[model samples]
Every structure is written in structure tokens, then in C-alpha cells.
Target: VRDVSEGEACPTESGFIADQDRETIVKSSMLPHDSAPRVTSPAADEGSMQHNISELTALCTSLQRKYSELQAKFQAQEEEIVKLKDRVKVLEDREGVAAKQSRDDAPIKGGVSMQGRQLLKESVMTQRRLQGF
Candidate 1:
């Protein structure tokens, strides 16, 4: 067994510290007293590393899929928002035209046209002259 310092990680044959050794070193450091370093065969370490790598890869794939789905949903919502804004603009334009048309067709006074006002003025003047008042 190789001698490793307390809290020091042992590097594998590949020159990288194994995940198990890292975890063991971290756990041993958390203890109140120093503990003997646990050793395992190279084959066992390799197997453990492969398993950890597989789990990490699976987790990465799942996260990527979720990110893609969220991105698609975001894009769809953006498109919907644009469509709604355009629809609102069109409706506002139509409302403005309709309001202008209504104003152009509306009477000047309360339910009375210019010609109606002129006839009413003439009738009042003629009645006043006939009554001598």
C-alpha cells in the first residue's frame, strides 16, 4: 500500500486522483481524529470511476434535455407575445379609424344638424313678429 499524508489524495496510475480517494480524504478530514488511509486495487478504482462517469454523463444528458425543452417553450411564448402585440396594434388602428368616421358623421349639436338649427331660428323669428313681441 502506498503511504499518503493525512487529507492528501492519492493519484491513480493515470496521474489523476480517483473520486473515491477524494471522498475518503474529505470524510477523514471531517473526523475529530486522524484515520488510516483506505487502499483499493487499481481495477476496483477503475470500476468505481467508470460508474461515477456513467452517472455524471446520464445526469448531464437529462439536464441538457430539460434545458432544450425550456428553450423551446420560451421561444414559443416569445412568438405568441409578438403575435398578440401585432393584433393589439391592428385593433387600435381600426378603433382610431372608426372613431374618426363617427366624429365626421356626428351632428354638431345635440341631435340637431346645421340646416335644422337654421329653420328653427327662422320659425322663432317669424312667430315673434306675428305675436308683436
Candidate 2:
């Protein structure tokens, strides 16, 4: 057998090369297997891919259910806060009315007290003037 490097030449049959030109053979002839090995079936791979997709879909569905529950709770809390705000507004209005009523009553009571003191002073002044004359 003739000695050859890996890419230098074909594994030639001696009689054929001498009979023909150099270009007739190629490097593909040197490979060990004539054809590729068939291992994975398309049907089995498709089933596995479908199973993974189904599991992901179920997980997403569960998350959506949890999100809806949280959304409902948030809505309820928001409504409760609004009700509390309205109650606070009513209480503040009542307090404002009570303060104004106290202010109005104070003026009326002060006026009456002033009038009573003025009448007492007039009576004392008239009695003193008569006693002097």
C-alpha cells in the first residue's frame, strides 16, 4: 500500500488510479460510514415537546387565577378607603359647624352682659345727682 497523509490523497485502489485520471475520486470516499445513523424518531420528539408546552400552559393558567384574586382584593380595599374618606369629610364639616355656632353665641352673650352693666351705671349716676341738689 502507498503511504498518504490525511488530506493529501484518496485511499486509492491501485488498479483504478493507474487506469484513470486523478480528478475522478474525492475525500468523501475516505469516511468510515457510507450513510448517517438514524436514532431519534420524529413522533417521540414531538410528543415530548407537546408535554412541555402543556405544563407551561397549566402554570400560566394558575398564575392568572392568582392575579385575578389579588386584583379583586385591591378593588375592595380601594372602595373601603373611599368610604373612609367620605366619613372623614362629614366629621370635619360637623366640627366646623360646631366652632361657628360657638363663635356666634359668644357675641350675643357679650352684648347682653354689656347692656346690663350700662343700666346699673345710669341708675347710680341719677341717684347721686338728686342727693347733691
Candidate 3:
């Protein structure tokens, strides 16, 4: 083992740090399992990664289902809005027709009673005499 002083360049070999440090730090040639018992095994790491992937996939699936449900609900609400708009239009058209029919059924001014027209003519003649016309 060689001593690695501060600011000193440690020896290296083809993509591997040579055994220079006194501490048993992991090297390229040494597998993680071959290190001290504190090191995590490659299989354990692989299993953990797989577990994380599975959890993510499940979360994605759940989110997708929720999105689909919300989309369907949104579509249904849109359809309901359209139906309500159509109903409003129909009601408005019916109101318009009722208003027109009421106007048509009501008496015209020319169809006033003879007594009512005579009173209007007398009033107009009195107003003309007062104005000397």
C-alpha cells in the first residue's frame, strides 16, 4: 500500500486506481460484494431498482385510470351543458312564439268600440276649437 498525501497524484492503471490508499476503498477490479460487509450487494441494488420501477409503473397506471375517469366526467359535463343550452334555446323560442301569438290575438286599434271612437273624436274636436284651428 502506498501513502496518498494531500495534493499528490495517486497511481492509476488502465481505468483502475492502483492500490495506493491505506484505507480499503473500492477499486475497479474489486466487486462491491468483495468489499467489507458494509457495502451493498449488486443483487440487492438490482432488486431495489426493480421494486422502484414496479412502484412507479403502478403509480402511472393509477394516474392513467384517474385521468380517464376525469376525462369521461368532463365529456359528460360538456354534453350536459350542450343539452341545457338546447333546452334554453327551445324555451326561448317557445316564449317568442307565445309573445307573438298574444300580439296577434289581441284587438287592433282600428277595431275599437264605436263609443270609444266617438269619445276620441269629440276630444279631438274640442282641442281643435280651443286652438282656433
If scored against the real structure, what TM-score would every candidate get?
A: 0.54, 0.51, 0.52
Q: Largest TM-score belongs to which candidate?
A: 1
Tell me the TM-score of model 3: 0.52
Instruction: Provide the clash count, candidate 3.
Output: 0
**Arranged by lDDT, best first:** 1, 3, 2
In model 2, where is the ten-residue run with the lowest total lDDT? 19-28
Which has the better lDDT: candidate 1, or candidate 3?
1
lDDT of each: 0.88, 0.80, 0.81
| Ranked candidates, highest TM-score first | 1, 3, 2
Candidate 3: tens digits of C-alpha lDDT, residues 1-133: 5557666566568325334542355464474464445778899999999999999999999999999999999999999999999999999999999999766755457666556677889999999999999
Q: Pick the candidate with the highest lDDT.
A: 1
Error of 2 at 57 (Å): 1.1
lDDT score of residue 50 within candidate 1: 100
Instruction: Estimate candidate 1's RMSD in Å.
Output: 15.0
Winner by lDDT between candidate 2 and candidate 1? 1
Distance from true location, Cα of 33 in model 2, Å: 14
- Return model 2's CA RMSD, one decimal: 18.1
